[model samples]
Target: MKIKKVKPYNQEEDKTKQLSRMFNTISSKYDQFNDIMSMGLARVWRKKAILSLKPYKHDTILDIAAGTADIGIKAFEYITPTQITGIDVSEKMLEIGKEKVAEAGLNDKISLKVEDVSKMNFADESFDAAITSFGIRNFDKLEESIREVHRVLKPKGKFVILEMSEPRMPIVKQGYLLYTHTLIPFAVKTFSNDPKAYKYLTKSMEAFPQGKEFIAILNQNGFNCLKYKTFFMGVCSLYVIEKYSS
Candidate 1:
């Protein structure tokens, strides 16, 4: 598949817009790059994230930055409320997601839209659960996105997240840096033309606050039940949180 070329990211739009533009440009080859870089472990990581949340039948789930709707598609099995909405800020991403939803014969069940995670267009308490798989770290105002998520969710709503992290173990962390920062970019350059996107991805993950710091951010955002589950020996993690009821 050919990756679309997006204009250079403008620093003027804030960090979130720049990141969204980067992902939107590379949307076509996203699944491929993710699978190749993770050695197909990304899918397993996503499954672990989904399992962290306990949803009843037909729950209203809002998946943020849901590129091509992978999590939304997988979450279908638990959609007792019939289906869920997957929203992203990228029009190109939503287009691809919509196609996938139709191909899965879940067009009626799952809906896709282009909306910013930091400022949602939904009503209060509109959803029962929400998730952003490896997506929130790109938010310009990560706290704003978390609180935005909180506002749209009903009391006690589940919030699940799968994110990349720098390993805490001294040796493991160095190995991770070598692989993600160096080898991953090499692989992307070889397999895809837009190598800068991969380069940016590496830098962004490195800049993100992971593990305990991230959990602290969640807590600050009013999220309880903070559980950070490590996978692939801590190369990545899934954070599950909940907003308590009054």
Candidate 2:
């Protein structure tokens, strides 16, 4: 399937570059905006995503698109990961994340780097587990990024993804659409310096493949869907997939 590419500025630059710029632009207020936009549900969702990794060997975890290092920081609360290596394209975002990690005295346990997932420098089977939260949709090369995750993960290692998706039900879908299309943009404009970033974010969420479609993509990229769960009327989804042993 040919997914429509949604860029923040809709410019000639590639999505990765545009996304890096967009996140960097909004890095300061990104966490604040998330809290207001999701009404604190994002915290619950992040905890759930992290807790799902408990059954696996997640000692050395790789966090993809680890913006603000939320997932890495929170992983400490739910699981006993020895180390978490977070990679993101936005340097500014990582800077803030580093500050948070330092303040939490987690500087030694978590490391944040400015690296693209599609072209990571990690070796084969470098991590015991890999995870991403609300970040896969922005991949400029989604397939390649998935493939990279597969390559870096140990055999049968888990790769969990937490992402936003449109609700499937009738009444819930109506309310979700209203909230995303109306209130989300309004909130961004009122609170963020880069309103266009959230505009691109909503557009990307709409265009990106979700649910079964996303499972199919993962299957083709050397992963097997282990568990699929939707929260809050499918507004967000958690996909737990494992690398093929063979």
Per-residue lDDT value at 107 in model 1 = 88
* lDDT string, candidate 1, 182-201, tens digits: 78877987887667777777
Clashes of each: 5, 0
What is candidate 2's lDDT per residue for 166-231, written digit by digit as tens? 998999999998999999988877787888888888889899999989999999899999999999
> Candidate 1, which segments miss by more than 4 Å at Cα?
1-10, 55-58, 78-81
The global Cα lDDT (0 to 1) of model 2 is 0.93
Error of 2 at 202 (Å): 0.8
TM-score for each candidate, following the candidate numbering: 0.91, 0.98
lDDT, residue 34, model 2: 87
Candidate 1 global TM-score? 0.91
Lowest summed lDDT across 10 adjacent residues in model 2 is found at 186-195
